[model samples]
Target chain A: MSNINFKNIKDRQFDAIVIGSGASGGWAAKEFAEKGLKTLVLERGRNVEHVKDYPTTNMYPYEFDHRLETTYTDKQINPIANSCYAYKEDSQHFFVKDHEHPYIQEKEFDWIRGYQVGGKSLLWARQTQRWSEYDFQGPERDGFAVDWPIRYDDIAPWYSYVERFVGISGNRDGLDTLPDGEFLPAFPLNPVEDHFRKSIQTKFKNRYIISARCAHLSKPEPIHIEQGRVQCQNRTLCQRGCPFGGYFSSNASTIPWALKTGNLTLRPHSVVHSIIYDDKAGKAIGVKVIDTESLEELDFFANVIFVNAATLNTNLILLNSKSNRFPNGLGNDNDLLGKYVAFHNYTARITAEYDGLLDYRTDGRNPAGGGYIPNFRNVRKQETDFLRGWAAGFGANRGNVQDRSGVGAELKTSLLDNSKWGNWNVHSHMMAETIPKEGNTVWLDAQKTDKWGVPLLHISIDYASDDWARRDDYYEQMTAMYEAAGFTNIKTSNDPRRPGNDIHEMGGVRMGHDVKTSLLNRWNQLHQCQNVYVTDGACMTSTGTQNPTLTYMALTARAVDHAVKSLKTGTI
Target chain B: MNGNRINRRAALRTMLYIAAGTMVLPACFRESGSKTIGLVNMTINEEQELLLAEVVETLIPSSQTPGAKELLLHLFVLKMVDDCHSPEDQRNFTEGLEGFAAMEDPATGTKFINLSPADRLRFLKQIGDQDNDKITMFYSMTKRRCIQGYMNSKNVMTDLKKYELIPGRYIADFKIG
Candidate 1:
């Protein structure tokens, strides 16, 4: 208690404390605040307000110094960040630069991170799809990781609650592989994409191509307008943070919504060191934090502490939280604090060209990025050499062709020429589900401590053979489908990248029924330590092919509901 | 930074009750002859900037519409090359500009800028023909930055292409034929 400022206990106390202000933590803050509980949210980075802070939101292409291209100096400094497609000059400020915080890579891993108050939610791709029962039963079917303590039915209502507020825009495709959720009007796919949908599904069984579901506002509802967000303007510059609040971000939606309740206190630049566990109480109570500006140490007392510091950092925080009772870490009686890690495989891609749709070209930018083909293989049962199948995005549009040959008015005329439209270029990328393995782990390095005195996280996650096999299956299936649809010049490439490049890493503190094998129980609570919940990506029992943000929000909302009721009944 | 410049320009246009297409250079060029704003990575004199301006203007001449020089795209090219390019490219660009800045006009015994526009174009063509790798490198680099700057110029986006800041509607099946 040497670091605890006891005299200021009244000011430092809270009903609920949330670490990180990204997708899940934002939901935790909103739910607890709406439930009439005073909440404190600790964000380790600067606060970025919605419209006022979106500096490049309305910037035209010409406004960018380098036309939004990554420069040599930028790549030299941000080797990990430059690898991300979203890390451009327009949104570079949102991503964490390598020089900002150093981490050891036992193997090459591109851990794309955004450290602002909104975290990576400010820069997410905004794809929000519901996970199905197949995903929940993945571990049980293939027997890889431990069985998930809860099923899709347990969290389905919470998904509806989250989707209604987050304003998910998706068509209910009546899918058993990818369940439908409460949604607004989905942006319609262009004629070519619809053509592919009609062509592929009629030829293949158990395969469907629906409009890609996203968090954008195709049409704003009353609840959305109440949050000061209007309809999406179709700018497609969402990576720069939409001024319309067209997309759901913590800065635009949850954090502000929680603030309006007057029960939330958001403390920015408060880097959380570790959770403080009480030795005799047999439960967790509060967290130790360091002021990022002055390095002044303090402790925040809370009845319930939710750890939603993304996936890897959550593991880092837990693994560094050594205590007298739990010597290895908090609730480390199982030694599963930083193991069974997995990520989505997104590097494999297939591209082709459609000669038709010559007259009908895509007009506007789709915030949804086009259509989605739900996971077709290993649904209801394992039907492939791989354990799980891949979900893919399908898109087709006309491209602009300008000859940059001659050096005069001919060139200028050619440059501004819009008369010549190229063939309808079609492409699809595989988002395959990777199996979680105990060998793929993230741990705190022994000797390397950061400026905050916390040990640097050592990330050693990699792909298994199933990942490569699944990629091959994706190429094979996509090629056959393209051939069926009369798409020519078809090419497929694996484009081997590191495992964590997908940025959907999960399962360092997975949920399970047994305390010996998992850290969290069914309600996202620590099996040994009550009053603490891990509802973010870290609690995922297995990685599903979906984006994972929507599921994280649903789990956080459900856990808050259960934890709040338990607090009233004195069971937690 | 460049980001702040864009916001300030947008906000200034909104507050000053001016249309967005106004790209006047404050009438300072006639009085001062040649002037520059700032540079972080590379050093350039007023003469060198003037020579670069000539290259951009020659690349895209002004007609009824604003050219690259009128839109101040040359400065953009400078900023991009300075902040965006590698040190080797920057060395070649600066060294290439120096070669043109010091070279005596063969027709008239003056510098390259003193020559007429027709002579300048011919001299540019002569330089283009030379096997000097640095000049060729400089010519191509300037051409690339010039074209990028010209196409993505505010004048081109707002006036020529009509870039919509808020399209509001996404016509999925827009007729293009």
Candidate 2:
């Protein structure tokens, strides 16, 4: 509602500018600032302070007027946003309305996005896992996608760096597919889950189940304690934002550290549209931003520009920054700027009912982070059906007394008593890796534009035959595993949901050895433009089965180091 | 001038209090023993809520621990049905309740509530097992609502389940009584 005023413009230059305040951008800002660089971080959404701004963190269900209800108005108005299970009255304020910033869905792309300071980091599932050698060496092994410029060794140290900072809690299993990492002590598995784990391990030679690797600080280290962070309160209400600062998020961790440095300037409600490329210097000098509130154009100059505006948005900005030298868009001469888009192919689910576990009960208050089965297939030897592998996250617990469905005195009695805890329920969802195909690409929609008049990202993606084949195999494997583990009345279902529905959007400006084929080199610096770097999910060369946020943080930190070193060496 | 300003401020405060009182107070202070009522506080009236409470308690009665009614699961269901559910869901629930209310035993030609506990249980079992539209609706709606409400409540979470803030050790085997 504020009026645009060009007279208020005061151009300021910085050593580096990061175009986002989410997972990667926050890390970039912290790393750059810690390295003595004056960094300017631009966030498209409103500033959200931790604890103070997390409105629903400690509230009970009954306290809310809507209690977890999704209204007909919500579904009718924002169908795309309403499709997700997370879209509820309890947390509706976190999501961006589809009407405000609509994108053309070439297919049915459920582009679940949050545009606040912390972005999707506030709403993420927090299941952290390390990418093993198999993930890094997948493309070359399968002959499907371009080989990564960097390998496991290159990213392993960085993963450790991130894990130590973010405070991941998990049990270390020396599995080849799912590697171990620097982790805080793992959350204990329940008795039923342990039974399943033992059963799976005994039945299958390589297959195993373990507790989920999560970003929750199980026990705060000295570094984390110094940052005023505490251990997890076992409050499952994380998506609302942990008021305890129990989990890793930009609002809770990196940005606060950056602020303490006093060398970082964070500007919220500023959307970076494109990077201003200097043709003669052969470098990106700065970024042109659209003031979200006032609709005014502004430029912030920097020696280095870090494009951490998620995967699709980063590519959209790159493709829109067209100049005389690079008419195809800045550093997009290879026409591979917005190509090789990949997302986790999530198509598997298993549900079952258990009997004779009546007295057993778990604290229904805590979130069921779920148990994980480390990837075993194609680890030691090759498998015929699928080249890569997938991991399964499964959980089981006693059904609540309120599970009594019928009405009347019987229903009432059934609902109240914890005596009938015999009825147990088990659920498992599989995260399968997909090959990064050139055809699975995102392009700027010439027809559609946002409120700021910038072109919208048009995503055109679908799972390949290999992905489908893997999904089918995953279904069979999961059902068999559940059955073998003594789960009764087992049922399996697959939705064949769209790519972005997983909310694990990756690839596009991928890392690769060949400059001609890839947009960025190993360091995530643009092949042609050295001063500009991308360290979001955009730099993902391959889509691994694990959640990608932790990896994004690690890569951003690594990229910051690389950028700083390059600057000193006069590489730009 | 000072007296006038003070009077105006007091008047404004009184107006605000009256407006808020009219809106919220009535819902909180309902007629104490009203049995047959439509809706109150985005849920069934206290009397109907009590009936639902009794019903849920019977379904999952406390042998070892507190039952559904004790956890006020029926109130939870009513709240969910009235406020949380979609408009279509609300319609379905009302229709389902009506159908249930209209049900009569063939032998005596009497309403379901007139039947003995055993007879009621038998009738409910038959209806529930067959997955009859009305019965299924009642069953699923009540069950899901009860569980969701009870599990999220502090009584069930803290007292019944005994939620430990930090369970440091991961024990593979624990006896289930």
DockQ each candidate and list the results. 0.45, 0.19
Backbone atom clashes (below 3 Å) for every candidate: 0, 24
lDDT (0 to 1) per candidate: 0.86, 0.77
For model 1, the superposed segments whose C-alpha errors exceed 4 Å read: A1-7, A494-496, B1-37, B43-48, B94-135
lDDT by residue (A377-470, candidate 1, tens digit) is 8887777777888999899878678876545455577767778998889999999998888899989988989999989999998887888899
Poorest 10 consecutive residues of model 2 chain A by lDDT? Answer: A1-10
TM-score of chain A of 1: 0.98
Q: What tens-digit string does per-residue lDDT give for candidate 2 at B11-94? A: 644543563343221122345654323334343445444545555554555444555654556655775676556766776766
lDDT of 2 by residue, A426-536 (tens): 888878888788888888876778879799888788877887788778888888888887889898898667778888889888888877988889899999897899999
